[model samples]
Structure formats: C-alpha cells, structure tokens
Target chain A: MTQITSAHRKLRIILWSGAITAAVLTLGLAAFRMGDDPSHKVTYTGEADIRSQFSLTNHEGQSVTEGDYAGRWQLVFFGFTHCPDICPTTLAYMGTVLDELGPKAENVAPLFVTVDPTRDTVEILKEYVAAFHPRLIGLTGSEAQVAEAAEAFKVYYERFEEESAPAGYLMAHAGHIYLMRPDGRFEAVFLEGNQPADALAEEITIRIAKEMRS
Target chain B: MIRTVLIAATLFATPAFADVTVTAPWARASILASRPGAVYLAINADPADTLLAVSTPIAKAAMIHSVETGEDGIARMSALATLPLAAGAVVTMAPGDMHIMLTDLTEKLLEGETFPLDLTFETGGEVTIDVPILGIASKGPVEATQ
Candidate 1:
C-alpha cells in the first residue's frame, strides 16, 4: 500500500510540472504574437495599422465624422489654441503648404483637432483656426470623444499642472501631422521641424498625384 | 568745460556697458486676448552673460522658456530660471524652440502693432527692445508677408 501511494505522489508531481511548463510556454507565445501585431507598432512611414475614425464637433459646431470627408485626403493635426509656440508654428506652416498646393488643395482636408477641449470651445476654435488658414477646420469634443479620436490615430497627450502657465495648466502632445488616404487609411506622417513647408507640400502633392493615377 | 566733459563720458560709457545685442525681436499676434503670446529673438553677447529675467508692460509677467521634443515625438515646454549665453555665440530664440512666454496680456497683440520687451542680464544689465507683432502666419521677421 505504501509503495503504491509513493508512486501516485511522484506521478502527480510530474503531471503538475508538465502543466506549469505548458502554461508558461503558451503565455510566452501569446505575448510574442501580441508584440508582432501590426496595430501595436508605431512607425514613421508606410502602412501602419491606424484607423481613421473620429466623432468630433467642427468649428462650426456641427457633429462630423470621418465619413463626412470621404474621397478626400485628410491632413489631421492635434493641438490646442492656447499653445503659444509649437501649435501656431505648425498651423502657420500648414497654411503655407496648402497655399502651395494651389487647386490641388481642394483634394485635401486639413483638420486641427484640439487636445484641450476644456479651454477650446467652438467659438474659440473658429477664431483660432481662421488666424491660421481658411481651409483649416478645427475640431473639438468631449474628453471621452477626444480620447477616442486621439487613440484611433495613436496620438498621445497628457496634461500637467503648471503654476506659471495660463489657467494653471499645460498640455504636452505629439506634434505629428497624419496624412490619411481617402479610403480611411494612413498614408504618411509629417513631423514638425523635420521638413519645411515646401518640402511638405511637395510630398503631399506627390502622394495626391499618385492617388490620381491609381 | 565740466558739463561737456560729463556728457561725453556718459555717451562713451553707455556703449561700453552695452555689449549684448538683440535682433529680429518679434511676437506672434494672439488669436484671443485671453491667450498668452510668445516672443522670439536672437541674442549675441560679446562677453558672455546670463539672462536673469524678462518683463513686458503689455503682459503681467514674462518668462524665459525652452521647448524640447522628446523621442516619443512630444514637445515639452519648460521655464528656465536663467539662460546662459556663450561669448560670441548667437543664441537664437525661435518658434518651436527657446522663446519668451508672455502671460496675462493687458490687451490682444494685434497684427501690425509693436510692444516693448525688457530683458535683464546678470552682467550686461538691461536691454529694452521693441518687439513687433507680426501676423499669426508669419514665419520670421522678414517673412511677415508670406
């Protein structure tokens, strides 16, 4: 009876060890697969798994989505009006880029999405965007809606307290301009300070011409 | 003779003490009166100095700030207590880089207008400059039309 009991105990230990190893291997493989997922990658160029979707309110206070601007290339940028330097510089250059595009600018929709919805109301956004360019449209929404839109584009933003700043706070955000294709796909990204207005315009013009041919 | 000699000394002493030169000092027109504005300029210090403080009459407070872009593509702006200037090195403050942040403006910075900015240095004393208010889309002081 003692011998039989010891054998059963040894068999139980072996089975438990085997189960643990299999579980660990399965989890490791799953983690590796997740790391390899395209959607998790953040890249500068090429086909990134970024979805073009946002439910936001335009500067005109109209509720719009990605579907509203279908069949046109979308040049989306995220920033706030209160931003004193970077945002204004980017918007200013974006205006120049659109102007350089000439009539081809009609095929592109430039959007300025606000990361600070608490301070950027519709009226404020209207005036701010007007100061930049006529073709530029400003978008703002509730915090949740804005978060959803930012996540869809893989844009990161965070608010921190600043004693000397206006309204006692400031926001740090990504300054990349995402170019989305007409079919709701990411075509490319433009980083501020990397290229001048003419270079950006030329790149966009080339992509637009390619789209026309295809 | 004494009065003429004192006048001559004052004139020569002023230039000798003023070694820091500022050029292309300009500010962007604000979209709203409630929003803050930024001023950019190039500083050339002949003897190397430290920027102690900045003040403007148009705003309640002016502070020196630096903007740095992180590897994650996020731009972060932080206030600097003092900015050191190397001798003969042109420290240029431009948009998306180092700038003077003007907060609590008394009025909107209208395009085609100008304001005064006073910068104090540890060794160079004070230099007051008239900062022009360019259009919001102006890339540089010369490119205001563009």
Candidate 2:
C-alpha cells in the first residue's frame, strides 16, 4: 500500500511539471515568432511633423500656424476663391456638414487654404469664406509661404491657360477635405461627391467619441 | 410696327420658325472689386441652334466653361468655344456644371442689381437679357433673394 501511493505521487508530479514546461515553451515560441514577423513591428510616421513647419496668414492678416488651430479637430481644404464651381460647391457642402453637427461642430474647425496666392488676398479670402460659413477661416500668404504650406499638405495645383482665357488665368487643384486630430495627425479624407452632411457628421461623431475615450 | 410684327411672328410661330428663348437668368453677387462670378441660364429652342459666344459689359472677358466630375469626384472646369443645342431640347446652365465664366469684373456686382448678358447664337443672332444678381449661395432663380 505505501509503494503504490508513492508511485501515484511521482506520476502526479511528472504530469504537473510537464504541463508547466509545455506552457513556458509555447509562450517562448510565440515571443520568438512575433519578433521574426515584420507585420508585428511598429513604425512611427507622424503626419503633423510637416504641418508644424508651415506658417501662413489668415484672413485677418495675422500670421497663423498649426498652433493657432490647436485643441480642436481641423478640417482643411486647399482651394481659391476664383474657382467658380468646385470651391464654392464643396465649401457649401462643408457648411452643411458643420451645421448638421450643431453644438458638437464646435469641436471641429474648417480651414480654407488658398492654392492661388497671387490672386487670393486677405480681403478676398475674408469675403469668400463668409459666403460659405461663418466659422470658416480662409488662409493665404506670400507665394513662397503658400508653396510651403501646400507642399506640407502634399496638395497638387497647377495654373493652366486656354487659347482665349483671361489674363488672370485659372488653376487646377486636387479637391480633398482632410480631417486631422487635435494633435495634427491626419485621420481621414472626405471625397468631393460621395460626402453627404449626415454621413460626414456620423463619422466625425464616432471619431470624436473614440478620441475622447483614448 | 414692323419690329412688333416680327416679334409676334417669332413667339407665335410653329416649331419650324420658333426662336430660342433664354429664361431664369441669374448671377451671383461678387464681394471683391475684381473677382470672377458665374451666370446661369436656361435656353429653350424649338429648332436646333448653336451658342457661339457670350459677352457682358460687366466683365472684361467672358467665356463658356463646363465643369466635369472626374472619376475621383473632383470637379474641373474646361473652356468651351461653342455649345450645340438640339431642337426641342432645353439646355440649362447651372452651378457645378456648365456656366458663363465672368472674369475680371470691372466693378463689384451687388445683390439685387441687374446687368445685361449678350448671348450670340449661330443662326438666331444675339439676344441681350437682364441677369439679376443674387447672393453667392443662391442656387437658382427660386432660391434667389431679390
């Protein structure tokens, strides 16, 4: 009877040790595989690093930077007032989106950055933005300053002329509304046509809630 | 008396002799002293016609442009020299689509003011009509605040 009990105890100890050893080996292999997998590695590419490098002037003729719009989400668009169709239409859409947001809209700031610096002056920008939304801020600067800002945003713009076009000419630019977090990280982009006010409002509301939680 | 007779004939004539009529002509008021603005109108023709050109004394230059939505959904304007209209068809020019590009305004176009736009047709000659100015956000004649 004593020998039988001793054999059973030895078997239990062997099983317990074997189970613990297996668990430890499995964890070790997982850690090793995670290190070998490139997808598991994290890379940091902060989008706002270039936004801070730009300095432009608002419609008030005050020098403004990314810091001026801190503490709130930024919705930025690059366009000019002379743009007869796209600029006004898209800005009006944004106005609708912001209006739909109501009080929560206070958390987002809409910015209109000019691609045509030569023609879009401070006064023109002031009146232009007012035509769309009261909360919209129009920004313009010198040629070089505007170039730097456009480069930072990676927006494409070009001046093209027609056979009998006016001396002032016209500009073709990428039409995109960029959504940025308060920390200046780019969150998403809204296309020109598919965006409805209610849809955009829903997306922004969700993002704001998630951000608050984090 | 002859001019009245001709006018009556044009309006009362059949489809074969009916002339094109321009309606719902409106433009957006400009805030800047010299800024571009767009004018929209609807052209109704009983017979086929072509819009050759448009001119206005309010702006130094006027051109016809068509705004096309690319696959990416961005609207881009391309200049058009002439626009062809089909018989019994109505061509409507509106914002974010086809429009008259009024460039380098001589003076600011204020709200509630009216200006003349001269539209030249290939066979119908030129017609001068008063285009009422509305706020920049006005979408059409009905929404315009006169």
Candidate 2 residue pairs in backbone clash = none
Candidate with top DockQ is 1
DockQ for every model comes to: 0.14, 0.08
In model 1, which residue pairs have backbone atoms overlapping below 3 Å?
A: none
Task: Flag regions of model 2 displaced more than 4 Å.
Answer: A1-53, A163-166, A191-199, B1-18, B21-23, B72-75, B142-146
What local lDDT does model 2 show for residue A129? 89
Following a full C-alpha superposition, what root-mean-square deviation does model 2 have from the true structure?
26.1
Model 2 agreement with the true structure over A123-174: per-residue lDDT tens digits: 8888888878999999999989988888877777778775545554677777
Q: Over the stretch A1-214, how does candidate 1's per-residue lDDT look in tens digits?
A: 0111111111010001121112221110000000112223343676567868999999999999999999999999999987888899889888989998889999999999999999999999999899889999999999999999999998999998877799888899988889999988999887655665676788899988999898
* Candidate 1 wrongly placed segments (more than 4 Å): A1-43, B1-18, B144-146
By TM-score, how accurate is candidate 2?
0.73
lDDT of 1 by residue, B26-144 (tens): 89999888888999877766567788899999999888888888988898889899999897676768778888989999999998898888888877677677888988877555455
Write down the RMSD of candidate 1 (Cα, Å): 23.3
lDDT of each: 0.79, 0.71
The number of clashing residue pairs in each candidate reads: 0, 0
